[model samples]
Target: MRQLLSYGLFGVIFFHLFFPHNISAQSVDTVYFSLDMTEPISEGWLKHGTEIVGIRGDQSPLNWGNTFEASDPDKDGIYEVAVPFNLHSDSLLVSFKIKVDGVNNPDDGWQKGRNHEAMIYQGVKNKVTLKWADEPPQAPTTITGQVEIFRDFQSDNLVPRDLYVYLPPGYKESNQRYPVLYMHDGQALFDASEIGQEWRVDEAAEELIRAGEIEPVIIVGIGNTQNRFDEYTPTEQVWRYELNRISSQERTTFPEAFAGNYISTEGDTIRFKTKHDTLLTMIPGGQFWQPLIPESEHAFFLAQAGITFTFDVKETEVNQVVASKPTMGGDGDLYGGFIIKKVKPFIDQNFRTRPEREFTSLGGSSLGGLITLYLGLEYQDTFSNLLVVSPSVWWDGQMIISKVNELPGATNQHIWLDMGTAEGEGAVESAKALNKALLNKGWSKENLNFVIEEGAAHNERAWAKRVPDMLRFLYSKN
Candidate 1:
């Protein structure tokens, strides 16, 4: 037996004679992603460990002229890297570090960053089959955050959104249906290691539930999609043409070649942001935005230039309705009927969710919050509890408040309205204006709860911090 073991080891080493010596140490660790985001290259990226990974495979040697590269699905003419997944770990904080012209990690506030973005992939591999590692990147426990991947699987490739759901310590043990809090930007909910970015929603939910301040409510933290600018934008398709132009550049720069990649780098950096091509094109009863990029590789595209241009296009949707329904405008009552109906029923049946007419609740921020308000008012019977976190009451000519005022306040419904003192230029004021309207409509101070996060901003963290408070208000019995 000992001699056979020795022979097996020797055979493995001999077989590797044709392979690269520097291939990631399969016995010790795994390489998750490689990234570069600089130059005229407009390669897109995914968020992994707060860093960016290049999904663009064709962009490589990212130097000035050809610095523009494609990402994950590397066929876009950018350099690419194929991250290895055959190895296993408990979990990992795996991602890439992009440095250009001698830039280093966490530069002082002085240096202009040359580090193009990359993708970030945290947590364990799919289905949780682990290997023999003394210390793996993720643990099997909720405290150690085995619950990651806040993606939406409504359809195969249509709208590949991310989501976050906090499974308490005893989640697997009980079948009791818990109250669910669906949050936007689901990707950033848990994982404080994500720096001051993304809301630490999971951590906060866990702590609050454990502390008994907030009941044990299930938090559904969903990450936004590239089409987020279109979907989340109040004006459904208003920003359509602009996005088309942006897509043209992105497609040209980060074309999705669903194959492997050709990448090279300095100081041993690799571009491993290649994408997978395995997706169900025709999913049952779901919407499809773009084709599903498979879980093929972990690579990156380093766009060296055109940052301002992309921002101009993507950011324009931030404070404005980027697009609306194809035939129906942002205020269209005719569009998205199929998707909304399907999603609501799916959530109700798939999970142990409370009925929308009674204990059910919904909330979001800015445009997201606006949606909940509109939905709740429109379908008052479906959702009885209302939690609008800094709703964009200013949009659509501020018509929602007038609509709410026209109707008599219902004692059966509970409304929790809040805003960050520093949400935006006029966020607090806007919230106050809506609060006043609600008050005039006969909502009492006790029933209509309002709050302001002292130092919180308009991000996931702010929402997470207030989630506990919001939950308490929503489920409170007056």
Candidate 2:
């Protein structure tokens, strides 16, 4: 293990390596990361001590980033540590994993697909707001519902996928068959650690049910696997295109790569010549520029560039492509088919559900939304109602809309298409165009509801607020 020696008034850093060769460590300000485990530890929740392991940035001699033991100085279970190393660059974005005892240890409780992240500049100090190992927010006491996870649900045709079933109140007591809403991103819909915000669908359903605004329905949230992006995309073609485009760094520079021409760079800030009508000083650096870069390599990118890029693009951009990987794309339609054939049957057999297409529904947000729309269109007989929230119609060069237009059908399907006003210009406009496409497909206003939410953004919290409205529209018998 390598140790980082901090420098003070003398401004000298010493590195103590395992081999006993003393080398001067670079001078950098100490960054403190504090984790309040008082609630979890004192309450007999976490028994194991936690260690913070830096997942990204300059782990060269440190054996895959630095691992520092958190000290509870006050013995209040509030562990605090001033990281041995300082921020070398302004662009340094660090991700830390709080292993309970250590990685691969049973006592080391950790959440899958959740990690503490920070954009650390020089002398920046941050705290882990959430509990050790991204714990799910406690279920609201006001809600009369519970989320049950179907661990490693097996499928003959496809890989294993977990299912989260949210049963409404009095479901077990009553022998009534309820409509089922199949949603993507099961892990995130209820848990905050998976994504920064949860959709709170369970809470929303309970509220709506109690208020009699919407009928009691069973929500089957299909937790995405490691191959989420590929599974969520409709066709292999779209998957291939996205995989190639995102992985291939053919165009990342200014003037030719990101659709914006390079104008000037004052310091590290490059002024790109904007030809687009929309006025913006900065956009989310990831959305436009990081389409090609994987997040795991962000530390490496930051190390190369002294300063990190900033844009007007908000936190919504982070949730958009979290599941994207550098692996080659495969057939997502097959994966979707597995859900329809294998998973749906298992759901129907286990729970009392309306198996008919009219009573069955599919929904998701972002890429999940895109796949839901595609599945709804392709398998119209399978799903009659769809909750499409901010579908990525821009995928495959906007091929989905064209495909929908080519398909001749006056199918009677209940569709709720919506986008937030605060969502990026492309997302908002694409959703509107999709609404038009649905209209052209013979969908009447009575069947389709197009909504542009006022001041709503693209995060899960934004989606949760609109859930009741979409549910009312889709399931209302009146």
Candidate 3:
């Protein structure tokens, strides 16, 4: 079923329709799904497919709502459905739900809290085969420590957030205070129910502490909201040229008829600019897919939520592109400032904290890693230990290096930088460059530790494997 709706843009009117059923018929691609449900009914009397609907395949609900109907055409209890849509990007991250017949109760569905995710590869017709989930999400194995989950922890500098506090063995029995490691991506760090893989920080910390390789420490896992990118990177906006500098000899590459209008040369760079009353709509069959433009010219990242885009023009010629720098927020610099100004205080006050820079550390991976570096530098007075796993040195055109260069000649900062070989060739080079820059900036060899793991890829499992080393280096007391 569909319903007609009305809309207006500054007096301009249009009619829009809402889809209550599957909208795959209007898509450019499709996912042919097959499921085996031969087993007797356990919960739901009837079954249907509910997905994390979106432009891409992620769990976000930007384009979610309608449940696609599935049928066992061959009477084998093997249901099937075809989901069609243009993937948001090159790949899609989504979770599917099996709903009971016309029931909306909590116990009416399988894989309720912890759902199964499917990665849909774009540009190809997919044939996905699935079986009925016999059980729920896998539970975490018991570790040697304790994990306390605090929900809706309030902070004036940040939105209401969750906090996972990990206490080493004998923490309750002893009156000893310990150093603290604050990490980001809290939801995905410790629980398999949230993300398919977990960093297992608690397990790593417990093992290291038990072996005496590292002193007992408190691990604080801070939960991140939807605006994760903005909270992790320091810069508010990043500017880059969308079009590269085209040589004068290549002027014949473009049409000469619209030289001044469609394309203009700014010094060594070629530029294009256009304006509209509301939105720019590329007409249908605009040769967008197969253009005469060079392959390099056609490559561009589409702007999405949290990523703001703008046109940069000088004297009416739009030649540059400006977009919101990916990470770092404003309320306490968003996540960093929140951790230093608000979170640290809360932890120090409530928990048995060392309450000193030498005993305070911050760490995370990827964007989280980048923000940890930013936070440590910006608040060197507060944090003396830093653990950065695969820091995004490429962020903001590698502007983070400039930040590193600005550090004083000597500081009591102990830093760790690590990357995996599987992260790609650029990662190795970036890690090396950052390590060199840190050394050149007066950081001592003993104080800075950089490691490259062999055959390792970027994920929670990989990070978990390296957590022992990170702990030993950052928390080793001589």
Candidate 4:
């Protein structure tokens, strides 16, 4: 006998009935996925060769770790797959992406952008059409007003990069000067971006200006280069500490005064003798060690155990350690100099801009955000507003917070600082600590706007959502 179990609108299950024996159940709810291979196939980006099309998602039988193959039964350009999901409730929300020739690797053929999400109702067969990452749907031209792109703008302090200048509406008609907000990562600020998603800054700015929600302003987007890490970071990052220690069995006693021995390297191994008389050896595998700060030649950082060591290498052994240390950062000052001396002059001369400090602002996110804070503090007289979004406060051990604490008094700049709860606890906590530091440094509540957006992730999508708020706070008519 066949028995049916109905869960109202939630779902339906079928069970094979046996005489007081075991039974098997099956779910009726299924999701159908279809993929269009015309574009990728025609463009030569994908060949309809033996490569299998599949779907990968967060649901059971559809995890990101592996792909569930789809079939082109009729040899048509369209490939389809029916996925059955066991439903416990009325509905299920699934997030997924399309993959081609994907085995156990998540990124083998994964599509970009934010993951596609769908709400699946029990007892319902939902159909979805997806395109490949090679052929992402073109985003509509959401840019409003005028944008001027300067390709390979030369800089004396840093490498040349493109610059995107966004002019507000009526700027061409009127002769009034507008305040300028300089942002980093120019490529990700517009509709077309190197990253899959864009921040849509132009759209947000245009909408807010039209609604009179914020004062009309000009925005400058500074393009980044391959040296983004060096240009954005204020100090060199310690990849990891290398310690060469003799085993307890191989211990050789030494005087307590000799505990402060200098680090010396022989060939590939770094040798140092500790007070315990144990020969410490560190095999140079990663980047060489450098002082975290500019003023110090040798810096002290904790490694395994409670032992402390000063990283001081002689000038002759610098080349030996060079092989051990990764490329050191601390080029942020030069980056700031480039913006101030090159980009700012060009903008001020070419455009009708309010060049005063009160009308100037800087904004960025992640490492870009970190550099923005560094620039805002370093050039307090040059910028009056700052939009620091999801800054990497963990950079160089929260050096930004210490920079704020060292400030004698807070300047009159308006600052917008924010972090998403989903960005991770370390990031959220770092933002909170920076907030408290700013508050203690005499920044008033009206001047510093700190927001912790719940359920927000650290990506362009989240930043795009907060752009309007950032503009409102930084350029409010009030």
Which candidate do you rate higher for lDDT, 3 or 4? 4
Most accurate candidate by TM-score: 3
Tens digits of per-residue lDDT for model 1, 24-120: 3343332333333332133332222222222211111121111211143543322344443322334332222232211122331111311123322
lDDT of candidate 4 at residue 379, scale 0 to 100: 96
The positional error of residue 302 in candidate 3, measured at the CA in angstroms, is 5.0
lDDT for model 4, please.
Answer: 0.68
The pairs that clash in candidate 2 are 282-312, 283-311, 283-312, 283-313, 284-313
lDDT of all predictions: 0.43, 0.58, 0.59, 0.68
- Report the Cα lDDT for candidate 1: 0.43
| Model 3 lowest lDDT segment of ten | 9-18
TM agreement with the true structure for every prediction: 0.48, 0.57, 0.61, 0.60
Residue runs of model 2 more than 4 Å from their true location after superposition: 1-144, 193-196, 237-330
Scored by lDDT, the top model is 4
RMSD, each candidate, Å? 20.1, 16.3, 13.5, 16.4
Return the lDDT, model 4, position 268. Answer: 29
Candidate 2 C-alpha lDDT tens digits along 1-478: 1111232101110111111121236545444656666555665645432223222212111111223445675777666665544333453434445544332334334334444455556545544444454543444332237777888888776678788899988898999999999999887776665554578788878888878878889999898886776787765542111101122223333322332322221111212222332211122121232111112322111111111223222322210111111343345688778878887998899999999998999999877888888888788889999888877776665667887798787577788889886454345777878888889889888988899987565566678889878878876645
lDDT of 4 by residue, 33-67 (tens): 89876665676545453355677765554654345
